[model samples]
Target: MELRSSLGSVATLALVAVIVAMLVGQQLGQPILLGFVVTGSMSPTLEPGDGFVAVPPVLADDIEEGDVVTFDARELQGGGLTTHRVVGETDEGYVTRGDANPFTDQDGDEPPVQESQIVSVALQFDGELVVIPSIGTVALALQGAFGAVIGVLSGLPGGDAVADGNVETLMVGGGVLLLLYSFAADLLGSDRGGRDRSRSRKGATRAGLVLAVILLLILVPATASMVIPSGVNEITVVSSESPSSNPTTIERGGSQTVTYNISNSGVFPQVAIIEPASTGVEVAETTHWIWRGQSAGTTATIHAPDETGVYYRSISERQYLGLLPLSVIVALHAVHPVVAIAAIDLVIAVVVTVVFALAVGFQPLRFRDTGRDTSVVDTVRRTVRKWL
Candidate 1:
């Protein structure tokens, strides 16, 4: 019985972790470890609503032709993450095509896939994709249910404001409420009369689990804030003798200044750093501090080569929460963007850990044995009735 209980606990924790990863991935607009298809793009290989393991670019081997990858598409189906197979490579980028498509993505309005644009490579064995059937179907069902709940909640007073808030914020709030309800149900419905001290210790374990969930609730979005807004920005430069008024069009051996806007729509202030990611791109002011609901502009000079037709230059932007000193953040960013993100996340994690320890301590929460014999459902129903 104890062995079975332990296995159940492990399974529950694993499931929770997967769910949290999916939620975080959705908010970040990138798959963390898992991804699914909503359309029959890959068809026989990956049917609609099938899920697959997504290996992050950092962990995956070098991308090559025939490898299925999930990349940020700029023009395909109005721009989002698209999973397809790399069919060819070019000096510019990779040529990708869906398994069911007749032509390559580059044959259409979609540009060649850049390395920076690829988020994850689908895991495969012997060239066959490892798929989790119907997982996306389950995810879609849960999303529909959540939307229905949100619709009902929107009908309540002051709930319209909450419904209009950020989706990630809503997810965190819903998670907290669910955790609280589960804790309450366990406390109210457990049979306490004949329970031994060992059984009471289980409540402490449950409390720790709740704490972990709360920690994830706070950290996932924090990490996403630092990661999601940071990526490569591409600039196309047309070089010719007859230079146009456009900033991107310049005479050979000349340069033009292009202004880029950095905006922060979130509640937290962000520190943004822009750096040249490709040749012939130079940022005038590399760092900008954007407060909540504000925008900042930075200028970059695109230099055309002595003998040029058309060229592409990239500028990389990295953002972090305004939680640490600017100097420290800048120094960490100089090392690497990931290093800066890790440092910021580490600082936030340490602060949150210390706060939680100060408030809750290392001990498990103790629950009194009130000898309640009610079922969890009954208890929840009664509580809801009382509140209503």
Candidate 2:
């Protein structure tokens, strides 16, 4: 009972968090929502698979130079949505650049970014932008699964002739019939088992309530996503030239400085990193890039490898998903790193429902070592109790 209740409580709390976050992030219907990094353009800072929350800018003019901001690409004849840093401010607009690039967006023959083109500013913590690393890969994987599922369905019995509409109708009808049978059986058997019947009905009522809440919460977002297909944008990444270590040759065990220029061209701010590819090399002073509208230089002191031959250093991007998911893996493991990427936010609520069942006082957790009582009524009680 305790475990079951904990599961239900977790689900309810998770659902509330998502709903509230969506509501707050999408304020004014600007479509500024949570998203993950899909490209390595922000490499060394925000690498592929990172996730971050994006909130719409309230005042475009308030957008300062050096702020990492997301904007429409059309303004520069670019692709879909692009996040880059504001490099310079002009009477015309904002000049942007990618940290990995050798030149600014304007140098590529594009005009300065205007305020109207701005979308959301990446969320920040302690004056530094935070991103959840490697979560976006899950969404990418789900897209792959969706295609595979379609292929499997198409190959079934009737092949292309197997209509999904027909299958759905049949499934719905079968569910309704099964539910009716269960209710009838419970009612008919009640006279012979009064206590059992009462317990069963109570369980059924709680189950029904939980199901209803879930459906109600889901219906809104599912409908919204369907209604606004354009609101969904693919991940975009931009990259620029990063610095390499100097004095290519160094005596074994000798020390040297590796300097690199890190820039943010996308609106999202990234934490620029300089890490050695091998344990033989050690670096110092790895700092977070503010990505404040311009390119900044980062330097790290490192000890050369004792072994001879070429070695490499990586400039990487990291994401901050906040403490809950980062500190505790299972807390946000719903966005599985390996599969089911498509489930994203929706599946999280479903996953947390182990707590939901217990939270609403529907089914109390059972931990007693008492003899087992695994009757069908107890199994089906949550739904039946409400109607009874």
Best by lDDT: 1
Candidate 2 global TM-score: 0.40
| Candidate 2: 10-residue stretch with minimal lDDT | 231-240
Backbone clashes counted, model 2: 53
Error of 2 at 176 (Å): 19
Off by over 4 Å in 2: 3-33, 58-61, 75-78, 153-203, 207-388
All models: lDDT? 0.79, 0.49
Worst 10 residues of 1 by lDDT: 196-205
Task: Supply the global lDDT for candidate 1.
Answer: 0.79
Q: Write the per-residue lDDT of candidate 1 for residues 1-388, one digit (tens) a residue.
A: 5577557657765676676566557656788678899998799989999999999775688899999999999899999999999999986678999999998998999988887788899999998899999887876776666667667777888777757766645575457545655565456335442464445543234546646767787887898788768778788888888788888889999999888899999887899999887678889899888899999998888999888687777898888998888889999888767778888888878887788788887776654444654444454466569899
lDDT over C-alpha atoms for residue 274 of model 2: 38
